[model samples]
Target: MTQTVGKRPAEDMTQVKLNVKWGKETYNDVEVDVSQPPLVFKSQLFALTGVPPDRQKVMIKGALLKDDEWGKSAPKEGMTIMLMGSAEAVPVEAPKNIPKFVEDLPEAEQEHLETKRFGAGLHNLGNTCYMNSTLQCMFAVQPLREALYKKASGAGGDPTGRLVTAIAELFKDLESGGAPFPPYAFLVALRAKFPQFAQQTQGVFAQQDAEECWTNVMYAMREKVKDEDGNPVVDKLFGMRTRLRLKSDESAEEFTEDGMTYTLKVNIEEKTAHVSEGVALGLKEERERSSVAMGRTVVFRGGTSLTALPPFLTLQMMRFFFRRDNGQKAKILKKIPFSLEFDAFEFCSDELKKELEAPRVAYKEAQDREIEAKKLAKKGPGPSAVATASAASGTLTAANAVADVDMKEAAVASTSAPTTSSSTKLSMTGKYELVGVVTHKGRTADSGHYVAWVKQSSDGTWVCFDDDKITVRTEEEVLQLSGGGDWHMAYLLLYRAIMVDMSGAVPAAVSEAAQPAAAMETEGGSSA
Candidate 1:
């Protein structure tokens, strides 16, 4: 025996005043919607008291209220109602028709399904792919994203803090799981901060360089976002220390300097088929300069060696150069290859290599064990525990003994050497894993489309973020971004340190890992 709450439809509902008594407190003139169910009325009472709607037992004139029924008489003004029961915890209801399990879908369908599941894609506002691509790459840095959200959330009111707040809100919206959305607010903030981004061509928005956008945005974040101790967040994640060396060929005198840099600039050449080659070339250079000791212009060899590696590393390829003939920045179309795993041990100074030795050995040992176990599993019968250990040991020894003779020789020929401070050190071995890339797909810097390819941490899968279009890509496909022709080539690369724990290694030895090599201090200009 249940009765409808009211004869009239919900739209016809009218508000009435009633007196509600709960415990020793009496709420006078409580508003109640007459046409709604009793549950709705109970919700109103729950608000006054701490009782939840389900736990509330309400009655009027000794008649127990039914959730669905209005009873014989409609609620009238100035009626007295008794509210009873204690607050009860309500169970959260699971959402219905969740997206299909991505793993169960076919490989072809998985990409589409994953794209839909993440519900993220940035809309391109005219030629703003550069901004969108760089933002996507920035979003891939999980720690940075979390820190920004915590610091900038709800602080969007101040004009000075609009850029950081907009970034935080945009990241929140992207993570909230919908359709592709435009980052109009973030763009407006960026343009306001850097008028260069607001440049237009004949009243139309102009295409900009993704690397330039990335650098300016990074500068803005560095200025705006600080940690509890008031250190710039970007510095901790992207800063690096270098040891600069200069030797006058005539005087045979050497001068050493220390410098800091945010991004490693790779000098690409026609022979630079790989990123390592460009890096090696970029590290050493010979230029003529005025020597105080020589009392004249003399040839000086100068180069940088890594003293410390940052948690996150950014490498910018020097593909665009100002063409003196046309007075325009033009791109080099040579193909250059990069790797998924970058071992920067060769680039480290001799001292840093010593500090990295223990962890490098440990990483090699772990890799060896995994490989041996996989091999044993594929052999049908299980190998004895002793045999497995012996095999892993042999493999580890071999791996540890491997030395890139050519790279070392090249370094010896040129002369070279190496962010964040944490209780537990990361990237102790000078190894980095590629996590994100910003690529360009046109011949010139001014007329190319930019796209981002970010590696999904949960599944270790690469997702191509081309404006509002998202699709999964294989590692091979991502690797093909190396420039060959008028195709997309990696313009900016982001790498994250590979964290591995070495049981016997002393963490303190590398505790000053991200700090400048202060022990070998000297005056030097900041590196680019």
Candidate 2:
């Protein structure tokens, strides 16, 4: 006759009421409706209704229960109610023969239990009394005084006893971490480990053998004193003595074991020392010869056999010599040999002679050209029509025409002149009275506002195109025409002028009547 609220079975629905008391305050008795059958009837009554049937409660509702017991159980109108579902109790199978601690672990993790068991056994063994006893027995030994006394008394003993003593001492020192060991500790260890090694030294007394031993010991000591990578700790402290040879006519050169010819002068007074000047001269000559023969300077200060000179000294010498040379100051070669036969002296003398002769040669060539130009100028106007036209122009004086002719000849001479195998060209052109022109590649317009051409007057005065306007009234400024911005054109023309002027050839001429007086005046002025 009873009907369930839904499709669930009737045993799945239950109603209960809970009477909660907190501290001294008692809450109202509340009905908790649930939807599950009980596992045990008595237990279900206590659990669902939160009241033991055996306990006496103040509230009693049997009359209301009869009104709605066959349907939904409803509490009195003023009372509160809570609804809950009672699900079937899940089964909890007891684990079989498993350790209490391993109940929560998975099967795979449980396998590690055996390993843990073994480790615990080992740990127990380590802490046992027997292990402590064994360690103490191994470390215990006779007192050092007793052992030494027994050994001095010639008591029979093992030779290794000394090793044990030494090892014990080493261990004590290691424990204390005190003073450093002696350098001979390695040798002591080696001798102790291999006693027979010392026997090999007996009956060998040759000087060469002694030297070899010394060398080996030195080398080994050097290695010991070196850093991890084997470079010396102090470079200057570990250098080898070397000899250099210097020749009378050659430069100073380092002597090597390899059979290379060198010109080193040995100082007779000092058997081990070499004359640095002689050595330097020999090396210089050798370098020059080699460079000339090879057509290029050969660098000799580097490679496997040579080390670089100290930078400070090299730099200082470079600065000193270069400044002296450029400044044309007298240089005192203090350390250099002074003998006339010395190669360095001869080289210096030859250089000086050439320098002295250069100006004179240049002067003679210039005089010759000037004489020729003057003769041409005296010819008045040439029979050529261009000469006539030039003569007709008011600008052409007899000296001017002569200067123009000389300039043309000089230009032709420059173009036809033989040159070295360098990629350079030269051109010289000027008349006796006119200025000489040398042109080269001009710079790009963006480079700066400077002309690239240079002009030299008949009198050896030279001015750049940009400045020529102030120097020469009739000088024309030529703009750069090339699009490539190659400055080689200007360079070539300048190079030609330099070559001709250095050759002392005058590209223009002045009247002979004007030459003597001018030269005398210049000489007098110079003398004054």
Candidate 3:
């Protein structure tokens, strides 16, 4: 008891709205104006679905039915439309009344039938029909056809056929259920037609091939070493039987081994080898020493010729021999061994050893000269001292002496004085003289303020002094003073006299001069 609403054949359906759920998370509401007769709706459907309009599915849909005017009045409330098309029902041609049997068919014909059945099943199930189409096309071609021919003739097919069949059957089942094809299978079919996809797959395979190549090379090299019985030698015995000795022109005493007496040398340039009697005995003794070192038994089969050895092996042997000969010296030197084409082994000779120690000898000599200079400086004044003949004739002025004493007291009160906690008590004194007037007070009585001056002495020492500290005498007093013209020089003279007198009062034993003359010279130089 169902009623169907059919389309109105002659009425024009101008506007139709289609609600489409396009893939996951996407929906579209499309309005189509189909004012013209014979309107094609597949392109419009794809436009509504957001699928490419020119894609195969849209083309196939269009081919199925170019126009279906009967769909005009179809109930449009979420009703699905089925495009009108003829089913793939080919006319069954009579085979001239011949009887049919599955086993009687030719092998090729039987295979074709089997493939068609599988392809049809895949199409019904909405499986990867595009991929199935490709396979059918491949089977129709040479190699694949031959392969199928062999398989049908009982020549046996590879496991790949079974995989392909199973994939086709799964797609067929999904199509039958009206479900969309799986994205992965759809992609596989799409990529087969796209060259970039093949390149990506090939790239992955290429990386695996490279890794396999390296692994094979390592295994082949490791297998090359074998024992006399043709079995691979144990890891412990591999490379254990080889020994190399270096023979140099130097004397046997110049090189020695810890537990062996052998001394052998090789002249690399001349390709000559030499062995000393001690070296011969040492080679025999090395067997026992090596056995002890390895904590196992070792037999010395007499040394063999290494003339055709590789350069790498030769260089390794040279380093081994060098270390055995002078391990301690080599460690101290931390030398890097190189080819004779570069520098010679100059660091290993006796001459080089002496040259290395020469610096220490020179250092000791310089230290002795320093000690001698210190001894000389410690001796105060030598015996031949000249006497001042008129020393008592010159009278010391009390005023000048008092001024000098006051200046000395002022200097002692300053923080610049040296401490006497140590044995050496250093005292520094200098004579300062005013050379230029940078600022001067005016001659007015109220302008008798302090003025600054630059001063220099015969030895070129200059100092600035405040003239306010000096006593200003009247013109009559200045006339009485014979040396008043250079008032700054007089002040400096008084200062030096005060320092000299004070020096006399301090104990001579505690003086810096009590130390060596070298110490006094150093103290004087530092004070300046």
Best by TM-score: 1
What is the descending lDDT order?
1, 2, 3
Stretches > 4 Å off in candidate 1: 1-113, 117-119, 154-160, 287-289, 380-427, 504-528
Q: Summarize candidate 3's per-residue lDDT along 361-469 as a digit string, tens digits.
A: 3323433544544455456434321111111111112112221111111112112233221222222221111122212122211112222222122222232323111
Q: How far is candidate 3 from the true structure (C-alpha RMSD, Å)?
A: 47.8
Off by over 4 Å in 2: 1-447, 456-528
Cα RMSDs, all models: 16.3, 46.2, 47.8
Better of 1 and 2 by lDDT: 1
Which runs in model 3 stand beyond 4 Å of their true positions?
1-79, 90-143, 146-528
Candidate 3: 10-residue stretch with minimal lDDT: 490-499
The lDDT, on a scale of 0 to 1, for candidate 3 is 0.25
Per-residue lDDT of candidate 2, residues 1-528 (tens digit): 111111234453344444433234344543333332111212223333334323312222332222113234333323432222222345889879967767677674465343321111111111121111111111111122222232323322223333333333333432232222221222233233333322221222111111122223323323333322333221212121122222222323332331211112211122222233333433342222233434554433411111111000000010012244445322112221121011111212232233324433543455564455556667765655445344333221222222212111111111223221121111111111212222222222111122222222224333332211112222323223211243322111111101112211222222332221121111000110
Worst 10 residues of 2 by lDDT: 310-319
Total colliding residue pairs, candidate 2: 29
The lDDT for every candidate, in the order shown, is 0.68, 0.25, 0.25
Q: Decide which is better by TM-score, 1 or 3.
A: 1
